[model samples]
Target: MLLQETAGSDETLSLMQLDLDDFKPVNDTLGHPAGDKLLQFAARRIQDCLTSDDRAYRLAGDEFTVISRGSGHPAKAHRLAEALVAAFKKPFTIDGIAVFVGTSIGISTAPPDGTNPEQLMKASDLALYAAKQDGRGRAKAFDAAMLELLEQRELLRRSLRMALDQQQFFVEYQPLAEGSRIVGFEALLRWHHPLLGKIPPAAFIPMAEADGMMPDIGAWVLEQACREAMKWPENYIVAVNVSAAEFLTSGLTDRISQTLDLVGLPPERLELEITESVLLERTVNNIDTLNTLNVLGIRISLDDFGTEYSSLSYLKTFPFDTIKIDKYFITDLETDPKSQTIVRCVVNLAHGLDMQVTAEGVETPAQAEWLHSVGCDRLQGYLVSRPLPVEAIGEFIDRAETSVSHALV
Candidate 1:
């Protein structure tokens, strides 16, 4: 309508796409009613910042679009976008609670960026995506480079989808040790592309999750880890990391039970590691899923503990068998007194709850010594050993056993 009305004028049309940052956490923390109220308040704030000639639309959940005719240039559109962002700098007062969120805006102008609604919206959407990628709460104008990055990410997504079927994925076991005695191995996933050679899990794991491939990949990991554990000492347990996507989408409990049964691996000998993100949903269904998995004698470890928001709440909410102090705290333990205190406190906290603690990323013997002194039940990282392929695990274990024997003698 703005384009039609201003067809004959020397006017420029600018479309701005806006996305609210971390909006789901509000709904998850406060009830959906509060989230709804916050969204309404946020929309009014955006609408209030616009002129009579400009209009705003709630295109979708926590996303809005501003259409401005006669905006003159990209600079003018940017100023309007900045004004909308500034409006969100304050918290939304919902039910007497001050809740916070920020906005990311993507601007696309007509004639230069696009001419029609479809083209303009796409450009603006891509710009919005770029703004979010650039850490949110900012404005990014439509640019050619953003499109290239998006294309590259799409290529990665495609490659990751076929990694499993192509037999390009494998699992490596990192020995989790306690004073030279190998208690178990933490299963890590590795991928080697025919053309790319080796792709780090850090680079592709999120892409796999985004593409909804984690369930299949996670199942394969569980089955493979179980089968491999059958080769280890009877008392040793194998730990496999599970993502939130896999936990929620897959029949994880049934799959674990069945995989253990098929491999003839005892349930007590398998551990499933979950990150704090898995507990964010907090729905009854997710809680039930965790409970069911726990009932099956599968040990559940809260992986990457002390890394995310509300670590203690997760411990209280779910029945976790172990907690892994994040590597950052371990890195700071030597130089920072606060890190030492935090580590000691976590060790005590876990032990108080009858849960074991694992100190991750212990590089120096000093760090290991301090952790062992503080009663950390397990140690994992380079100081212990890097993740090794299945063929190499036996040798690693044998070497560690010999070293322990020498020390004892």
Candidate 2:
């Protein structure tokens, strides 16, 4: 209908595809009945943003499409997208529960975007992909450059699939120091592509997660890290990051147990680092997995704390062995009084909970001193050491241990 209407008129059609961000959590936590009510409320809210001439259609689960026809199509579409996004910032009351859900909008205009329905939809999808990738709770307009980016992403995805099979991936260990003493090392994944050279974890990790390859890649990391850590002193721990996808996978506890048994690594010497996002969906599954891992004596550390919503609430909900304060707080610790206050409060709270506190991104002696004074149990960042391959860590650990022994004398 939009294509037909635009065929005869000079006026263009603005195609906007909107997706509700993090909707699964509502269903998982509140129940699907609540999710249905939330969707109904969201649909009404979206309709309120559109003019009477514009029409909104439910495209699929948690997805809505709006077509607006006008002379100034792109301008009107931009305004509508912004309005929709802003409106969702407020909580929607469903079944007496206040549910918070944000929106990601992808806009494609007629003619330049596409003349037919299929082309416009595809273009809008590409734009929507970019919007979500850029980070959720945002709006983006379709452009030619996005197509090029999609192509590059596709190539990278293909290469990533073959990466594990070809053994192109490796792990880099960054030491987590307890004051001047080396207590543990965090396993960070690194990929050296045959053609793209070295690809950082930030670039490839998410791609792996999205491609449904994290479970395989993550298992490899766990097995390899534990196997290597077995060679280290029995007192030292090896922390491995667990992606939300990998955490949600079935048999995670069994995998970890198998790894420990195979490598003869003590369960106390292994730590699994997870983020708050992992708790957003599948609450029951996450808790059960954590409980099983807890039983296995593998320590669980809440990574990048104080960066997401309800940091304190997470501590109350789960039995985390440690809380690693996010780097953002540390960067502003000296300049911002609020950062200092927050760090102090978190340290106190973690101690109160009997959980160890690890401060990340500590880059200066002054910063290290301040965190130590505030009762931070462990520190990790460039100030101590950059991530090194397994071969270099033997000497690194020797130097770290020697330095700490000297400090004690």
Candidate 3:
């Protein structure tokens, strides 16, 4: 069986050259079944790209390899792989469900690279790994450094598997205010790794998504934060961060609803904060999931508004009730006159849409004054108070209450 795959040609040696070079994302968002169908479709499309003699194989999870023989222009082979990837660039309509999948590919040749199936595939995989590292939905030829990086990435992926389950993570709630009154808390996920003091979300969130652990990790975050908030004053609300992955994951909306029910927390007390990137050109299911959440009476805040290229078109489409001006604008409003103007414009625009605007990262008195003067409805920052643990925050609020009562007396 293996021998037939390794004996093809200089350009297309059986089992030696890697065809269907792209690595498909096996997102936990899409769930296992959709992932399975996409993987099969990838294998079929790759096989169809080559000769009848070629065969495709699944390495694991979302990885696949195809064996084909040919001496065509390395460019020609890439062009064929490009065609397959292009087909995938369009959203996949599977079982009446329209979704999207992206992949990266790598290629290799036989005899010189390897006559044996294992040796040939190793070279091709090294090249493919390089392609994916460069970014998904692209292709690359074999290289050595990329092989080493792949081994390192494998080690990183393994350590992250039990990260959330092991309790190595926690959330810090930043305060948001309507003038002097606290209105909500933005729940920010923090990973306090034992060996590494802190790992940036940028480093691990994408890694978790790649390793297929996002749904579990993300759901854990929702449950923990909701339970924590349920202990707070009834008027206080918690904003749980939502990633685009939630839409792809089948049971996420249901899981979240179940979680809220478990804690007996009102949906209005919980807010799901999502960035504009998640809503831009999203699949139908993803959009539907957001709509479902909106109907549940939970507040949805478009966090970090104006950071991306998503225009007013997307903004007008959703039922988001709040839009948080990104910290960058707030941090500069004190000195950068332009920033002050931008904040004013955004506040006006948000009010025009009937959406409340909250200014984030309000570090100093001057910035706060500017935001307030410009009609900003809310303020959140270090000046207000950095994020504290649940117990710490309770104590902090108690101290503030005593201070106010003393003044009243």
Candidate 4:
């Protein structure tokens, strides 16, 4: 009705949609009562930023919408969004406990972006999604480009649902080497869309996770990888990456154990790799899950280590068998003194914890040699071999072993 009233006049109105970032962890950790209190405090902060001409509404959980009416709407909307984001920078004290959260905002202007509520809301929602995708805690204005991207994403999502059934998905194995000898292979998921050609995991994996498809997809990958590993040398382990959703899913350990038994692969021959996100919740259930997997004799590795803020603390908490240094630090090892120092420190830290360290993206022999000098337990990257299909693994392993023997000679 407000939008309808504004449409008849010469007034320009802007709608801003705001979402709280990292809000779930607070709710999960502190409980719903604290989350409600935090939301109230957040609302007060947002209200303090608004003028008499603007009104705020709580759209849903951790989501707020503001309607602004004025001459300079875009500027006003931008300023309002910026203010809300800045306001969240300060911690909200709940029960004397300081809790921090950030906000991402999307802005859509009336008379330009849309005139009706539905169109305007859709526009703002799309903009908000873009804000989150571009590393949240920022604001984005709706544009035609966002609409196109949305269409592409929707198409991909629908296609992804049918990908497994259509046999468009496969697993690739990248070799993990200790010095010149290959000790294991990391299982990487690959998708080949019939119409879109090859889709990168970075592009589709998150989408699948969000759509609740990872558990099913992850199960298939585990079975397929284990089946293939059965053909490899008994000593060569196959490492499979596990998403946070899959890691936290109930009966994950049982599913994995079933896959191994079904494929006739020993539990010790498999390694499950997970990132720090899985440990962010620090739930007792998560710890219990890890403990259960450990009891099953499956090697659990911390993948892409040293990327998150609480990496050191996670190392202290979790019983990770191996820590894989992120590729970002290893990429500059040859040129940057800081990278060298950080990598060496991480290697030492992992060793001190009785956990091995694997350097990712070791693309050059110099990096490999330096990593080995620091007692890095493993190396994996393009220098050894690119991720190969199941058909190519046998030949590649044969050639790799032959090359290692010649080097030793």
Report lDDT per candidate: 0.85, 0.88, 0.72, 0.89
Error of 3 at 171 (Å): 1.7
List the pairs of residues colliding in candidate 4. none
Query: Candidate 2 on 57-85: residue-level lDDT in tens?
Result: 99889999999886687988998899999
The model with the greater TM-score, 1 or 2, is 2
Model 2 worst lDDT window (10 residues) = 400-409
On the 0 to 100 scale, the lDDT of residue 195 in model 2 is: 92
Clashes of each: 0, 0, 17, 0
Q: Per-residue CA lDDT of candidate 4, range 1-409, in tens?
A: 5766777567899999999998987897679999999999999999999999899999899999999987787988998889888989999999999998999999999878987888899999999999999999999999989999999999999999999999999999999988669998999999999999999999999999999999999999999999889899999999999999888888998999888888899999999999978886646888888888889999999998877544476777777899999999999899999999999998998899999988888787778778878899988988887889889988888899776434322
RMSD in angstroms, candidate 1?
Answer: 3.4
- Model 4 earns a TM-score of 0.89
lDDT against true structure, model 1: 0.85
Task: Look at candidate 1 and tell me the lDDT of residue 388.
Answer: 91
Poorest 10 consecutive residues of model 4 by lDDT?
400-409
lDDT score of residue 406 within candidate 3? 35
Ranking by TM-score: 2, 4, 1, 3
Estimated TM-score for each candidate:
0.86, 0.92, 0.63, 0.89
Residue ranges of candidate 3 with Cα displaced over 4 Å: 1-153, 400-409
Instruction: Put down candidate 1 lDDT per residue, 174-275, tens digits, no spaces.
Output: 888877687889999999988878888877998888888998999899999999999989989999999988988847788788888899999999889988
Q: Which is superior by lDDT, 1 or 3?
A: 1
Residue-level lDDT tens digits of model 3 in 43-137: 66667666564566777666667665455544555666666567667766667776666667777656656666676678877877666657667
Pitting candidate 2 against candidate 4, the one with the higher TM-score is 2
